[model samples]
Target: MNTFLYDVKTKCPVCGREFTYTKVRMSHLKVLERRKDLYTKYDGIEPFFYDPIVCPNCGYAALSDVFNNISDEGKKEILSKITTNWTKRKFSGKRTPQKALESYLLSLYCSQLKNDKDIIFAKTCLRIAWIYNILNDSSNENRYLKISLDMYKKAYEGFEAYDGEIQLIYMIGELNKILGYRDEALKWFNKVINHPDRKNHSLIVNYAKDEWQSLKI
Candidate 1:
């Protein structure tokens, strides 16, 4: 057993089964690099490998943050669509990159079944892209990045107000730049720089400025 990984007891919202899922210790995380799009490289275990909590019994899986927040109706959907075909499998031990990829894919599927927010799908897709980035699989990485970009755009256009709004705007630009959509990237970066609430988010504003300047060159 890896000392860096610890099990957390979780109750599946869809199937009412209690299970344990793996999580990485925060103390063990060492940031090696952070890309403009916020894909982080870590020195030791990839913490994200343990992010999508899976239920061994019923196949319910989602990012840890939203794992237990499914609605009653969502539970029914998962029961019908996922649990009915779920094979008993455990995801509690330390995970390999491939296993992590599988977990994220499962989370993506469950998110869609539950009609989760666009941001949730975007986040899952972005993580999938990051994993592919680590695997040096540019083709799959770009495919997921494009999906993430589309989802982010839908989320940005749909919501009036939400937490992380500023960051989301900035991510739109960053992802566009990453995907080589220079004109669209520049437009979003400008939106972030000139946003009325920029004063409250100096860090994001500064990042936007830096990316904007880089694009201009």
Candidate 2:
């Protein structure tokens, strides 16, 4: 057993089967850098590899944050669509980049099947893009990034006010910049800088300002 990772027991909401997944120890994490799009580079094991929780019993997969919150309709969908075809496999051991990519893609599929929030789709797509970036696969990276950007735009258009709105706005700007949409990126960054709640999110406000200024130069 790897000392940096530990097994976490969780009950599958879709199938009611108990299983364990691997999670990196927080103390062992060493952040080397954080990209503008919020992808972090770590010195040791990549914790992002474990962000998606997969059930060995059923094929239900989702980001750890939203794993236990699936709807009744979602459970029915998973049982009918995913669990029926799932092969018994374990994702509890150490994961390679390929395994991580598979896990994230599974989560993305499940999210779409469940009609989850656009933000959830955006988040998952963004992580898939980040993993592709790590693999130096620019084609797929841009592909997923574009999908993520579209989802974020849809989410922003639908929400009037909600938690993390500021951060969501900032992500739109950052991803636009990363994807080479200079004008769109600048417009979004300015929106963040001038937002009514800007003062409440100083960190994101500063990031927006930095990106905004960089674009002008």
Candidate 3:
């Protein structure tokens, strides 16, 4: 186990197996800045390195936030489609960036099998894109960025279960700018700028103005 990372015991929601995964120590994280792309830079350890946990025994994997929220039916589905054919592999001990990416990818695969909401999958893709960004791997970064953007758009247009419509609009605008969709970015930015409640969220409003100005330059 890496000194910077600590072991976290978790129960697999899909297979009922106990496992341990590495997590970055909170005390070690040093935040550098909040990028326009929404990724937070860290000086010491990356929290995202421990975001996805995988069960080595059954190949069940998901982000920590959603890992324990599985339904009985979802478990059955994963067992049938994922676990049954899954070649057992362990992800214990210290984790490299590449290993972390692999765990997120497995979680993504499981999310698809469970027919997870677009938002759920989009968030995963966004994290993957951020990971690639940290690695300076432009090809993979753009690939996941496009995937995440598409899913976020879908979720915004059709998913009523998701809260924070205004924030989602802001995110969509930021994502568009990241993808070089300047016109679309401006459209959403303006929407936030002109919203009735814009005054309530000074931070988001300020960000919208800054991004909107950048587009005009």
Q: Which candidate number has the best lDDT?
A: 2
* Candidate 1 overall lDDT versus native: 0.89
Model 2, stretches more than 4 Å misplaced? 160-163
Residue 9 in candidate 2, Cα distance off native in Å: 0.8
Order the candidates by TM-score, highest first.
Answer: 2, 1, 3
**In what order do the candidates fall by lDDT, top score first?**
2, 1, 3
Instruction: In angstroms, give how far residue 75 of model 1 lies from its true place.
Output: 1.4
lDDT of each: 0.89, 0.91, 0.84
Global Cα lDDT for candidate 3? 0.84
- TM-score of every model versus the real structure: 0.95, 0.95, 0.90
Compared with the true structure, what per-residue lDDT tens digits does model 1 show for residues 50-152? Answer: 8899998988899988888888888888889988888898788978888999999999999998898999899899999989988999999999999999999
lDDT of 2 by residue, 1-217 (tens): 7788999899999889899999989787788998777788888678889999999999999999889878999999998988899998989989988999999999998998898889989989998998898899999999999999999999999993336788899899999999999999999999999999999999889989999999999
| Of candidates 3 and 1, the better by lDDT | 1
Runs with alpha carbons beyond 4 Å of true place in candidate 1: 160-162
Positional deviation of residue 157's Cα in model 3 after best superposition, in angstroms: 1.3
Steric clash pairs (candidate 3)? none
